[model samples]
Target: MSMVRYKAIIAYDGTLFHGFQRQPQGRTVQEELERTLSKMASQPIVVHGSGRTDAHVHALGQVIHFDYPKERPLEKMRFAMDTQTPEDIAVKQVEIVDELFHARYLVQEKVYEFHVQIGKPRSPFRRHYASYYPYPLDLAKIERALPDLLGTHDFSAFCASGSSVEDKVRTIYEATMVHDEALSELVFTFRGDGFLYKMIRILVGTLLKIGNGRLEETSLPKIIASKDRNCAGPTAHPEGLYLKEVKY
Candidate 1:
């Protein structure tokens, strides 16, 4: 029988897994999915993700594609995959697609969100979900600074050093920050054609610095222009980052 191409949207609480990609030693989201899929297919199966999420980083709409050796009902396959996956991961939707569809290569855009709790005592419940910041933030300054990040640029400054991809140019379609007054939390939304490794986390860290006056609001242009990783701020905690959506 010929293999069938299957595309799936999934969400996972990544706190326990090492990351999205499979590592020889640590647990990973891909490993769990592949294990379940291989068992169901009665053969080894490989699952390819849209992209990788760092350890402890969550996903609400991550996408993946895999090929199964046999034909099966899409709904049943989705249900089986969902139920068989560990508690942290969920198969949201599944569909058959053309053989040429490639999740990573065909991706057109991605949305990411980074959350921070501010000026409040830490909540035991949210310790692993939201990053905490005790400093006073100037929302106006941060808002004003966000526009500087829009449009195309070489974002090597914001990228972590471990990334191997040589082409660092990416376009930002939208960038916004809003405060959730009820939770005393700051929510950052970034829509871009692509993001470098740990790009959003590093951007959030720099934005926090600018918000708190450690870095001037006007510093974004200079920092981005530098294209030097050391010119950027630290990478934020993985706990506070989420892969909100992937657009193909």
Candidate 2:
């Protein structure tokens, strides 16, 4: 049978799914997407995602590419999946791309936003979408640490234990923290060449500590130099993390 490569942009709440990647048992974003494609195509379809996100994490612009057995208009394929897929996930866009355009490898950079609620009691609307940290933060402390994090560096300290990628180096294009006065939340946006397992969360966690005086602002440089996970701060919760966008 012949095949056509289809690229799709999808967004998911990620609250219910186990994770972005398929697991041995429970449901996942990839499994759900593949299942939807398999049912629609009347044959098994393999889908590959831009990256794997942990459980409870969300994505606003997750990318995927799959080989479809049937030849059909891109719009039809998108619509067919959008109307029938579960409510939490959505098909934002679809296109027929060059066969070599992999969703993962072709990615030029990725942007992730981590939200931390600073209010004493988290708002009902923001509770699930952002992480709640009631402690006071020293904004200037967090600010002072941002510039040191930019540029290419060996980020082994920020990544978690499971990653096997030998080259723990990644370039941070932009690392900015903005306070949303209306929401009373601290939003940290990280744009980078790539992120490793729990890297953003760890970086944010370290910054959060520095903001609260739990960790010194000068600790960032040493953490990067150490290249040891034990030297960094804890990994923040997954709920606050979001895969904002991936640019090719």
Candidate 3:
């Protein structure tokens, strides 16, 4: 039989796993997934993830690719992996793709959401997924700041200090902040071509400072010009961030 290549869409609550990549000691999404696939194929299998997500960061549409010598129906492949994977990690779908298809290189866009709860107390159910801020925020100020973040620009100021990527420019296709009164949560959603290490977290941190009146809306341009990591606020918690989707 010819070698069969398969692509799968996976979703998982990342709180339990170390991250997407396999680690020597800790449990990881890739390790668990490959172990299951290896069993089904009766051979060693390696899975390639679209990108690496930090620990505690959830994903709804993470993509992965793997290969095996034996050809199996897609449903059987999905069932085999799902039955073996941990409850927190699930295989949403599977499909056969061309041999040249790569999970990381073919990605066209990615969307991420950051959740923040502002109130007197934190909800038990949301403690693991959302960041809590006790103080009230100025929505108007945050809205004004969003415009400055639109369009392509040098985001070295918003990225983590030690990131080695030479190109710091990224386009923000869309960015919006929404308040859900019933859930008492503030959600920040961003869609971009790609992102630098900790870029979303830094953006949220800076916006929170502006909302709390610690930074003025007019200062955003100066912060961008400074191109200094210190100019931005603290990196938001990883738990609050979720990879909502990856567009091909």
Judging by lDDT against the true structure, name the best candidate.
Answer: 1
Q: What tens-digit string does per-residue lDDT give for candidate 3 at 1-248? A: 67888999989998988888998878889998888888877888999988988888888889999887877788987888877888998888999988999888998889999999888679998988888888768999999998888888889989987788999999999999999898899999999998899999999999999999999977788898898889988899888898888888
Error of 3 at 30 (Å): 1.2
TM-score of 3: 0.95
Q: Mind giving the per-residue lDDT tens digits that candidate 2 earns over 23-132?
A: 99877999888889999988998999999999999999999999998778778888898887888989999998878889998999999999999967788898779998
| Better-scoring candidate (lDDT), 2 or 3 | 2
Comparison by lDDT, 1 against 3, better one: 1
TM-score for each of the candidates: 0.98, 0.97, 0.95
Candidate 1 vs. truth: CA RMSD?
0.9
lDDT of 1 by residue, 145-210 (tens): 999999999999999988999999999999999899888789999999999999999999999989
Order of all candidates by lDDT, from best down to worst?
Answer: 1, 2, 3
- Tell me the spans in candidate 1 whose CA falls farther than 4 Å from its real position: none
Tell me how far the alpha carbon of residue 242 in candidate 1 is from the true structure, in angstroms, after superposition: 0.5
For candidate 3, give the lDDT of residue 112: 92
Give each model's whole-structure lDDT: 0.93, 0.92, 0.88
